[model samples]
Target: MVTALRGVSERAEAWLDVERERIGLWLPVALGAGIAAWFALPAMIQWIGLLFLLAAGALVGVLAGWQRRLGRIAAVGSAVMAAGLLLIWARASWVAAPVLAQPAVTAFSAEVEAVEPQPAREQVRLIVRPLRRPDLPPRVRLTLRGDGDGIAPGAFVGLRARLMPPPTASLPGGYDFAQRAWFDRIGAVGTVLGDVVRSPGARRGSQPLRARLSAHIHAQVAGSPGGIAAALVTGDRGAISPEDDEAMRRAGLAHLLSISGLHVTAVIGFAMLVAMRLFALSRRLALAGYVLPIAAAAGALAGAGYTWLAGAEVPTLRSLIAALLVLVAFLMGREALTLRLVAAGALIVLLWRPESLAGPSFQLSFAAVTAIVALHESPMMRRFLARRDEALPLRWGRALAGLLITGLVVELALAPIALFHFHKAGLYGALANVVAIPLTTFVIMPMEAAGLLFDSVGLGTPFWWVADHALRLLIALAHAVADTPGAVATMPSFPRWGFALTVGGGLWILIWRTRWRWAGAVPLAIGIAALLAQPRPDLLITGDGRNIAAAVPGGGYALLRNRAGDFVRDTMSEAAGIDAPLGALADLDHVECNADFCRWRQGAEEGVTRAGQGIARGEQDAAARVILASRGRDRIEGAEMAAACAAADVVISDRWLPRECAGRWLTIDRDSLAQSGGLAIYFGERPRVVAALRAGDEHPWRQPDQLSGNDEAVPTDALAP
Candidate 1:
């Protein structure tokens, strides 16, 4: 029994050791990345302070390293880094307060630096270089009408027009454009003015060698291969139709289009292979190794435009770094890849730009690498690989299986994050990836390379055919998968706890060699369950002429009111969990009133007599149990209505009250409200509240005919009390 216990104890100790090492390695990387993101902070002071902290920490670490206690020194260093990162984050949030506090502006002037057309929506994401201001940054995004002028990618123009924050409804669980822009150093946002004035500074100067190369490749495939070449080589999809984009997404080939890890790996692998073959005649391993690195550098330069266009996102960077490391290792005659390469790459990126740790690309990229490494080292995968030394057919079969397995594993690993951040899962992602990966690698990439080569020779016809064929194939694949039923599964957004649980579980599954991997399922299940258990709101009110919404519940009815089309559309769509028609509420029960008294009645429900002026006297006793008014309502009338519905709930309009109102009033402006009373919520802001009302909550107030003498409307004075 003692011997058996000792064996178990040893295993546990080993596991703990691995966990600690993983944390030590990853934590520093996360901290570093987080720090780098400080540049995106709106305030300068915070950035300066963070810079100071980081500098101080590094100095301390170096000083401490002079002593023999290396581990202690490292710990201190990590703590300093973490503290600096936290301070930076805090400062950024402090600066962001004012931005969020201010109401969104509609009209503004901005300089357009780049325009990416989204043909499906007839829109374009205008990357604007904002004019310097005392308070804000110098960049922003303006998603405006896409009138295809065959606008070049880097054209600069002055734009002036309305700009509003993104509607909450349009993107449920996807990227927050506002937050993303903020992180990308974007300031104020707005659309084009009348017509974009082509700025004198708009023209790009004489292009660099890489830029010229990209332009040449683009020109060759522009008319023929179009979207496919754009995606494969340049990572530019502004020219791609929405249909094609959606199809690619559905087919799981979306990664290929993005010029992510797969593309980088392919470039490196191809370069290495070509180098090896060319140097085979020389019979010199060193020469072959050197050639591969040079080839990789060339490939990297060739794909520079794509990398930059994709924002040189963390995952792409990781792949590039890994590839470079592999070449270096080969040049040194190292037979095996090391985790240190990945660690070093991560450390370098983190040191340069720490804020990347919070990004999905960073997480996904690192997760994929970690998964690959862990799996490759696992007994199961090694055993299988060792036995599979077959010819082309067998190799192909193994490769296919590996692809499928990797896709499934990565998808599963990223499931929680996707559900939390995107609020949806691509059900057909694995299947889509299977088709898209090879097509992109074997077909699209080669065509792009050939096109570039042909363009260099001033013969564009062959390249055009390749581009055309690739685009057609890509578009068809994306459309077929995207259109399939249940291709996307929508879920409620999960909280941080759920995300933590899910991520932890996923890591366990990937890393744990023992049966403890099954334990990971617990957190994953919890995350999914939490998302599924989210409650629906009772009432939803769209902001009047603004991109805001509110959910209200009182009496027997839930009221959803909004004047803005975008707000209304978003609220209804989110609340209903469907693509609600734009004008669906036009004929539904609605209350129309100016700044004064608003009347509420169901458009569909009959016998609801429309009361006029006398109704203001509170004689009939049947106005909504709550009288919701907008801002700037005449005080005398508002007081009267409040008094009339004193026994009932009087929810003042958010607009009517000061920017900061007392918590009791069923606040109705842009903010959200929770439903409590026995009210079948008709509102659509908070889903959970609506779900509660659906579970049967009778309204507090009933008509005089239905009520007894003991129950009469409460006085308005009682509302405040």
Candidate 2:
């Protein structure tokens, strides 16, 4: 055993000796891990062991300085990890804002922070700051049911609005908007009740500029083409029809609409190229060694300006930072693109907004960039993918091949994240990107830029006309690709554990430069297996307790009611991994549903039960039935709830059931739904629930959690309830 252990140690040291160069690349990864750790905590505490860890890390770092190789690496990693935790803790504290406790209707004058004008509907969304109540939160989002005329960012307006705490997930395994709202410092979200009373104020901000530019683009190009152009240029996507947006998503070209790395790179690269060329025209400037830095500065300035115009959203800001880093590296006479640069970008983003670590934007963007950089860093891939001087046809073929390969690589890298967030992954993104990337890079963007430039001179019509036609081709391409068979792979939910394993394994593969990196395939394969084997929920309930969906024996879901809006249906569909509409419960086989309730007979015979966690196989047969009460609280009585609860294996209710009413296995009602946020019911010999929000969840923005834990509840209790 000793001999074997020594041999292993020697081998590890050898591997470390060779792979040590890659250590620096993982600093940002360490930081991100810390940020993720902060978010994973159920509740905040006094530094959450930050001080001890920091001190311990410092001690290790100091000792490691006295040692060599592996010790030094551990020291650096530990130190940075601790620093990352500190940075996030500080960020969270700095951005922490009061959360709205209950619903309220009050008239108040407030300064508008942002405005999103939707042409499709009369309603407009605005983020505002209430001027008066010391008890009120600083920021609230209001959706006014009107044309929202004469209201712009920086305008002060007095109006009566119904304000409530931001919503949690609409259903289990769905996005949590409240967490995002917390970071954005938006405490309340509601609708305006009365007409707006606009007050005069200087309207100057990115929204005004973005609104005007977006409107101008919309005027120049009509319909979907104009919508796409406007979104690309100004990041105002209200103009894009839902049909076209969905097509873009399905085609895997939706990134075009978001001002991300590609757009940022294009703007900066073009600016740099132009600046360099202009500087080269002056021989004195070129000879004075000022060309590269000056061009880089110009590129950075242009990128910053574009980012500002794009609303400085997380993704745009991240891309701009990464681009600036590249420019900085280039001017310093170092390799511009590297994993270290990706790390720096990630570190900056995390430090700026620690909560962004939980968001798809940060994860997806950073993951994509990291994978791309690692690919380029590999000597084998570099040799294989390197562009060479050759015949024009050969060069074009190689370039196309490279684009396809990069797209495939990025697609694979992002698949887990996509699945975790959206319950689906685009399968044909690589094939679509092969055409879309160049189309956006060479044709559409140039024409659009020219159109914008010429619009100022009042001669942009022809350019916009050309852009419109080119966009038509792009949209057509997106539709054709989206309609292709097996365009996307779907699953109901990729569990957090599986997602962690996959991302961890992927990072291992990407970060390590040694052949041992192949070991990551083991965890990656295991995570994929877990994702595939994950059991589907037999039933799902919306947060509001108004809608319920049960799994059909064969496939898809049976809805208790069809009157639910598209949003609810869509949310359920995504969570159920069914791309089509959910059918009515009454239409399903062996199911009886009425105005009051729906009963479905399903169990072992129909493979409704899994082996573990719930009722085991063969424990029950098709004779078993699950019932859900369809009536609202005011309409349903306690006796009826008890009877339904007793008659079924699982009981779900739209009304609040008395404490005495408990089903055979599980009973869920409006009261429980309020506590759980939403629920995923798994029917088996022993039915179980997966809740979006857990009991005692004390996150500040999780409604009554923070309020109930303090005296804050008194006012909220008296005011709204």
Candidate 3:
């Protein structure tokens, strides 16, 4: 043990010496670690308090370094880590908007701040300042029942709403809507009770520029193609139908729809080329000064403008930073793409919004770019590119080869991240990118930009018509690819620790400059093995406890719900790596579900027998394993309730808890669901409870005080005294 410790200490010392000249390379990584620490922490820290702690830590670190003769770089690294902590804490505190304190609100008046397009209806963002109760959250996101035609941004409108707090994850390890809502500063979400009445003084201007552009696009053209155009132009995907969106995602063409690195680079490149040519044509400019700077400036403006038009989302923002760095390189007469610039951009972005570190967009985008740049800088790639003296056709062939290589590298780099977050990857992503990328960069984007310009002069229809045609072709290709056999592959939920391991390995590979970097593959392989070994949950219960899904024998899940439960069933199926639809899986041969109950017959299926019988509902003692009840409670009398309780080993309520279930056997009700977020039951020798929301999840966003207690008994008649 002592020998090992000494060896580790020596290695660490050598590593520090090596990193001294490249300490800046580790800043973004340290910042990312700090952001991760914030997420793992049990409590949220105030910005002021975090700043004080940071100051104290910096002072201590510096004093210790001076007293102990520690290297200045090492000491500064400690201070930088402290700074990172302060950045994330400050950003979180700054964005911690008020949340509604009420458990349920039947009615409230709000001033409509913005109107957004949705596939089903018009979603409205309202600023609600209650005259009687000023303590409640001021901003709320309300989804109306229909298309609010007259409603626009900045419209002061009054509407009755039935509001509830933003929902948490519906099932264990599922989507965390509450976390997203917290960052978005949306306190409550609900539907309008009726038509929104706009005040006579209703106006506009508070709406985001991107939202307004999206509205205009929809007004100009209506349909899926128009939705595609709007999404490509303004990053507003609200109008796209679920079918189209899913098809695009499965085909791996979804990135083209969003303004990303490809779009920004292509647009800037085209603009610079145009500016250069125009300047070259002018004799006065040719005689005056260097035209490269002027053309590069124009390209920068174009990139920034596109970023604003696309709402400056994470991907677009990262690409814009890259474009600016390229311009800076041009001005300095140096190569544009470099590792140092990538690090600088990453540091700037992390400092700007530390919360972005947790998002898939940021992770996947940065990973792909970093890998692509590293590949371009490799010795072998440089040797390959040196063959520019070859024939024109050979050079063209090389370019095509490079494009294919680029696609493969990016897809490979993003594979683990996609699996960790989405659990699905497109098998034909590289081929799809080869065809789709050039089409988007050269044709679709330019056409749309031209259309936007021409529309201002009343000559936009032709350009838009051409753009729509291209979109149709792209959609067709996506549908074709997505429909292909095994076009997309799904995997079981990858463990978070495995993801962490993979990320660490990737960073080591990218950040190191030594042959020892190959050692990263060790952790990468181990992480994949761990991910493959992770077990899928046997059963999932929705947060309301109204819907339940049990894994089927081969794959997929059989759901038992009073209503359609599409979201829960599909989510569970995906996590289980089930490729089929929920409805198709609902009628698995071994499963029998009726209006009152669902039962898995023993010995009817191979895997189900070992997995245990999943029983839900029915009055007889035959369904003793599990009983789920939601409806007919208003119909059941006192005696019926007692009999129902006596018949089952466990009883679950979708709406409210019954007093009879307080300590008898085990019960999951709305109260427990609210407190726990969601439930995953693993039927090993005996059933075990696995909560979605851990003890550490009780942050300000959750507003734990508003959630019901786990052991609390709720009366069947909630309004009863």
Best by lDDT: 2
In candidate 2, which residue pairs get closer than 3 Å at backbone N, Cα or C atoms, i.e. clash? 615-685, 615-686
Better of 2 and 3 by lDDT: 2
Q: State the weakest 10-residue window (summed lDDT) of model 3.
A: 707-716
Candidate 3 regions exceeding 4 Å error are 1-22, 43-74, 102-105, 119-135, 201-212, 215-222, 583-604, 607-651, 655-666, 685-688, 704-721
Q: What is the clash count for each candidate, in the order shown? A: 49, 2, 0
Off-target runs (Cα >4 Å) in candidate 2 are 1-6, 43-66, 200-207, 387-389, 603-623, 632-634, 703-721
TM-score of each: 0.68, 0.91, 0.85
Which of the two candidates, 1 or 2, achieves a greater lDDT against the reference?
2
Candidate 2, residues 488-507: lDDT per residue as tens digits?
78888887777778888899
Please list the Cα RMSD from the true structure of every candidate, rounded to 1 decimal place.
13.3, 4.8, 6.5
Q: Give one digit per residue, the lDDT tens place, for model 3 in 452-530.
A: 8888999988888888888888888899999999987777767777887888888778777667677898888789888
lDDT at 49, model 1: 67
Quick one: best TM-score, which candidate? Answer: 2
Per-candidate Cα lDDT values, in order, are 0.52, 0.78, 0.70
Candidate 1 lDDT for residue 646: 42
Q: What is the Cα-based lDDT of residue 515 in candidate 1? A: 67
Model 2 residue 30 distance off true place after TM-score fit, in angstroms: 0.9
In candidate 1, what residue range of length 10 has the lowest lDDT sum? 700-709
